[model samples]
Target chain A: MKAIYKREVQSYFNSMIGWMFTAALTAFIGIYFMAYNLFQGDAYFSTALGATLFVLMVLVPILTMRSMAEERRSRTDQLLLTAPASVTAVVMGKYLAMLTVLACPLAIACLCPLIIHFNGTAFLLSDYASILAFFLLGAAEIAVGLLISALTESQVLSAVGTFGLLLVLYLWDGLVAYLPSTAGGSLAGLLVILALVCFLVNALSSNWKVTAAVFVAGAAAIIGGYIAASDRFAGLLPDMLGRFSLLGAFDSFSVDHVFDVRGILLYLSLIALLVFLTVQVVQKRRWN
Target chain B: MIEVKNLVKRYGNHCAVDHLSFTVEDGQVFGLLGPNGAGKSTTMNIMTGYLAATEGDVLIQGHNILEEPEAARKCVGYLPEIPPLYPDMTVLEYLRFCAELKKLPAERRKEDLDEVLSLTHLNGQAERLIRNLSKGYRQRVGLAQAILGFPPIIILDEPTVGLDPKQVVEIRSLIRHLAKEHTVLLSSHILSEIRAMCDHVLILRKGKVMACDTPEALEEKLSAGGALELSVRGSAEAVRSTVLTVDGITSCEAQQEGDTVKMMISADGDAREALFYAFAQARQPILEMRPKTATLEEVFLDLTDEDDAVAAQAAALLADTPDEAAVQTTDAEQEGTGDESDL
Candidate 1:
């Protein structure tokens, strides 16, 4: 695992991807910092970080588009898979390598809070905490990119797919607000979601019996709950999805000026789930 | 030692490997001989744990590849059909990374790296990026990667597929050198290469094992002492009578020419001498006569061809000889035991 991690990290720098990613990210952060803090009188580095969050939707894919996709394209995955390393180890090695690349700009950004303190009155505690939150958010996005890369062989497709998904996530909060709020409407929305989950299960497992069972159980549970207390279903669709807003969690530190432990845990859990899915994708290719 | 048992791999509905089974003995060079799409690469991939078999198991040095992967993988080194390499790294960096991945002892990695570099003749190109190296050099780098830890078993899928003749010979000799201490299993569609380098060859066709034996046995068993093509300057009756007098002639078919007779004659053994004397005594001048011994090429074509009758005949002959050949191999191994220990 260490060998793979070292090689992946070295490979990132050996090519132009690592240096370009770091420079582009840092440049974008600098632009935001100048606009919000350096030029304006605002002393909170966290505001600059908040303005820069949108930059990740474009940059995270650059760091991760080639992570697993290039290995498949070049057939180097053969060397990794046939080695003594497990699938989890290989995926973790790659994920951590991308995290290490994402860290470079963050490490440079780490000085911004200090610069703010030297310049004038600064919210040092809140600013450093926001940087940590920003790092986790980027790390979570990188994990999502890695999984998309694992799904395909073409790096272009991987990058586009990741960018598309991240764009959706960037608009997640606005999208959730458009969901139905009435009891019958939310119940209908939940049924459609249940059907989509059943379809996903069928595609993944290729077992109609299990998918059917899940659909039946989910429909029964949703309908049973709606019938027992119709009030509970009102606005339930948006309320549930609102909890999953990745940016919402990060906004607590930068916008609300408070440490949101649940948000941190959500980012960590998303990273773990995406990494596991990438491993499963790689392992499934062997059998197919 | 490596064992593949009742292996079957299916891609959708097409069977890539079907009920294929073979045991590669320790310290021997085993060859998987097959034409394209014959599942040679797929079988190698399964044996090395790169791909999972639809059914059956691969055991490497007594450890099941699926159940005890790390233990089994530690004992074997594999080079897939295409040499899997990262083009961005220099040759030395790539090999050192491979050495670490194979988990060679940290203390001995430098020594092992140097030895493998020299063995594959990549020392001068060590600092060059793999992207700049030629195909042959890249192949050598892949070979060096596989040989990094000196695992007990080495599996190579078509190690000489794209090389020039000189590179092929060098790679063959390198494989031979590796066979002294490590058991090597390599696949090749080229008949002569396998015959020259392997102790045992398993021929595959349509995902089935067609024949498994030594090269000499495969050639000798399928061809019944060979055949003689004769053109005699005489009437068909006279030529036929004269050829019938040969002692060991098994079957003869004659074709009439303007003033000569052409005959294809199979024999139990060499009957050229008897035929010559019989034609001389009969006064039927022999216009042309040439003995045709079946080469491995012919046997390979017959075994892999879609013609069921001829292929079945060759397969039957192969099946009949392995029992005898098995005993002979043990005897040969017993004789070579002294040399084996010296390695």
Candidate 2:
């Protein structure tokens, strides 16, 4: 694992991707910090983090585009797979290496709060906490990019696909706001989401019985609940999806001045889930 | 030692390896000889724990490849058809990375890396990026990677495919050198290459083992009904009539090649003496006499009922000493069993 991590880190530094990512991320964050705190005389540095969230949609994919896709394209994954190392070790090693590369810029951003404090009144703890959340958020997105990169051998396609998904995530709240709020519409939306989940479950476990059971149970529950209490279902889905807006969870740290434990857990779990999918994606390639 | 038992690898409905079973002893250059599209690479992949077998198991040094792959892989180093190289890395970094991937101890990694660099003749180009190296150099780097740590078994798939003649010879000699200390299973489509290097050859066609034995034994089997080419200085009609009139002669064909008659003659018994007597009676000078030898193509054809069956049969039309073998029955039996399935 350490061997893979060392190689991945070295590879990042050897090429331009590492420097490009750092330069782009630091420049963007620096510009935002200057404009927001310096010109606007913003008291809270967390506002700069809130502004910088938009930059992650582009920067994270560039940082992670070649992580697994290039290995598959060049057939070097065969070398890694045929080695004595386990798949988990390989995944974690690469993921940690990407995280470390992501860290170089995040490390530079740590000084932003000190700079703001010198210039004016800066809430250091809130600012640092938001930075922590921002870093964890980037970690989660890097994992997502890793999984996306593993799904295809074309680095360009991987980058484009990850960029698309991150864009959707950025526009997540507005996307959910457009959801229909009628009980029937919500019911239909719930059923569609349940059906998609069942599809995923079926694809993964190859067990039709459990998938069918979930679909049946979910249908019965949704219909029964809707029929019993129509008012309770109104506007429920959009509200729930808005709560699930991954970046929306971070709103408390930046906008509400609250350390969101649930948000941190969500980011960590998402990271775990993405890493697991990356492993599955890699294993599936061998089978094919 | 490695044992592959009843290995079957199928892609959906297409079976690449029907049921390949073979064994390599502690020290031997075992060759998997086959044509293109044969299952040699698939079998090698399964044996080295790269591809999982569809219906069988590979045991490397008593460890099952499927169940205990890391343990099994520990005993083997594989060079796939295309050497998996990192183009961005320098040769030195690539070697160092491979050494680390093998979990070679830090204390010994420098020495081991140096050893492989020397063995593969990669010393001069050690610091060059792999992308800039020539194809032959890339192949040698791959060979060095596979031979690292001195694993007990090294499986190379077409190791000499892109090499020049000199590099092929060097790699062959290096493989032979590896055979002294480790088991080697190398696959190739070239008959003479296998015939020259392999201690034992496993001939495969359409995933079936057609024949496996030492080259000498294979030659001796196809050499049973020997045919002789005789160039006699006489009229074609007269020479043919005299050869036909011999008592033990089974069949004969005579053709004139520039004032000399070339007669392909076969007899029911050792008829060289009978033909000589007949020729002596006719007073025709037997200018040149040479026995025809069967190459491996004839051997493969004779076994597989392939395209060369007619040619082999026409060549083998000479009847006489049906059992003029080059070895004893036990020698053939030992060699045949060594190649049969999982010896």
Candidate 3:
């Protein structure tokens, strides 16, 4: 695991991808720092951190698109897999290498708050918390990119798929508002979502008996809950899912200046889940 | 030592390897010989713990490859069909990384890398990126990696496919050298290499083990000693009748060669003395007569067909002699163990 990690990190920085990724993020964040704090004389460093979140969605896929996909394409995965290393160790080693690459620009991001202190009065405590949140968010995003990269052989497909998913995540709040708001519409939407979930479960497990049971049980639960408390159904669809939204949770530090532990839990779990899924994808490929 | 028992691999409905079983004794050069798309690589993969066997198990040095892959793999080194190399790294760096991955002691890594490089003749190319090396050099680098850790068993799948003739000889010689200490199981579709290098050859066709034995034993077992050539000066019928009088001689036919009669005898044994005495007594001056035995090429052709039933029939066609005498029959008549057809 250490060997793979060292080799992956060295190769990333040895090529143009590492420098290019760091430079692109630094340049974008610096531009935002200038616009949000320096030129405008704003005291909060977190606003600029908020502006950089959108940029991370595009830049992350570039940095991580080739992580696992290139190994599959080059057939180098054979060496690592056939070695004594377990699949989890190999996946985590590469993931940590990507996170290490991400850490460089983030180390630069840490200086923005200090620069604010020199120029004017700075909200140092909130600023540092927001930076921690920003780094965690970026780590979560990179994990998502790594998982997508592992699922596909084509780098182009991995990059495009990650970018598409991240774009939706960035617009997750706005997209939720567009969902049906009326009680009947919300109930119908709930059923459709459950059906889609059941469909995905069926596709993954390929077990029709369990899928049908879940399909029936899920329909009963949704209908039973709606009838017991009609008001709970009102706008509850968007609100429940919205609470789990990753980009929306960043709004606590960026928009409201509140540290949400619940949001942090959501991001960490999602990151762990995606990393596990990446390992599963790689394992499934060996069998197939 | 590696023991593979009743190994079966099927892709959907088509069986790729069909209940094949063989054992590799320690310190022997075992070759899996077959044509294109034969299960030589598949068998190697299963033995190396690369691919899981569908219906059977591989035990490497007493550890089941699937149940105890790490323990089993610890005793084996594998070079796959293609060298799984990182093109971006220099040869030395790539090998160092492989050494570390193989869990070699850090204190010994540098020495081990140097040893592997020297063994594969990659010392001069150590500083070069793997992408820039020639085909033979890249193959050597791959073999160098396989030889790392110095495991007890080494499995190489087509280790010399992309190499030139000279490099092929070098690799074959290296395989021979390794066989002195480690159990080496290598595969090749090239028959001559297997014949020249291997102590035991497992001939596979359509995922089945056709025959497995020493190269000498296989050729002799399929001896077709009925056909012979004779030289005599007489009428064709005169020579044929003289040759037919010999005991154990089945049939005789003669063709003319200038002033001499060229006779081919279908005999159960060496009819040299019988033909000579018979021709002299019949007033037909005799010359040369020799029985023909099947070559390795014929043995290969007659043993391993893509369709098992066809190969079984071809094998039966050549197995006229009883089992015990057959192996010695070709050896006694053909003095050299080397191919008789070439002679």
Chain A TM-score compared with the true chain A, each model in order: 0.97, 0.94, 0.94
Which structure among the candidates has the greatest lDDT? 1
Query: Candidate 1: which stretches are off by over 4 Å?
Result: B229-264, B267-292, B307-310, B317-343
Every model: Cα RMSD to truth:
6.8, 5.4, 4.5
Candidate 3 lDDT, tens digit per residue, A2-62? 9999999999888999889899999988999999999999899899988888889988999
Enumerate the chain B TM-scores of all models.
Answer: 0.82, 0.85, 0.85
Better of 1 and 3 by lDDT: 1
Q: What is the overall TM-score of model 1 with all chains considered together?
A: 0.91
lDDT per prediction?
0.88, 0.82, 0.82
Q: What's the CA RMSD of model 3 in angstroms?
A: 4.5
True contacts kept of each: 0.86, 0.56, 0.47
Q: Candidate 3: where are CA atoms >4 Å away?
A: A182-231, B229-242, B253-264, B276-291, B306-309, B315-343
Candidates in descending lDDT order: 1, 2, 3
Docking category of candidate 1: medium
- Candidate 2 residue lDDT tens string, B1-343: 9998998888988889998888888898999987776789988877877677779888999999879888988888889899999998999999889888988889988888888889899999999999999999999999999998888999999999979999999998988888888888999887677887888988787787776777776766656354678999988999999888878776678898888999777666567888888898999999888765555654544333333443234224222142543212223323222221211
lDDT of 1 at A266: 94
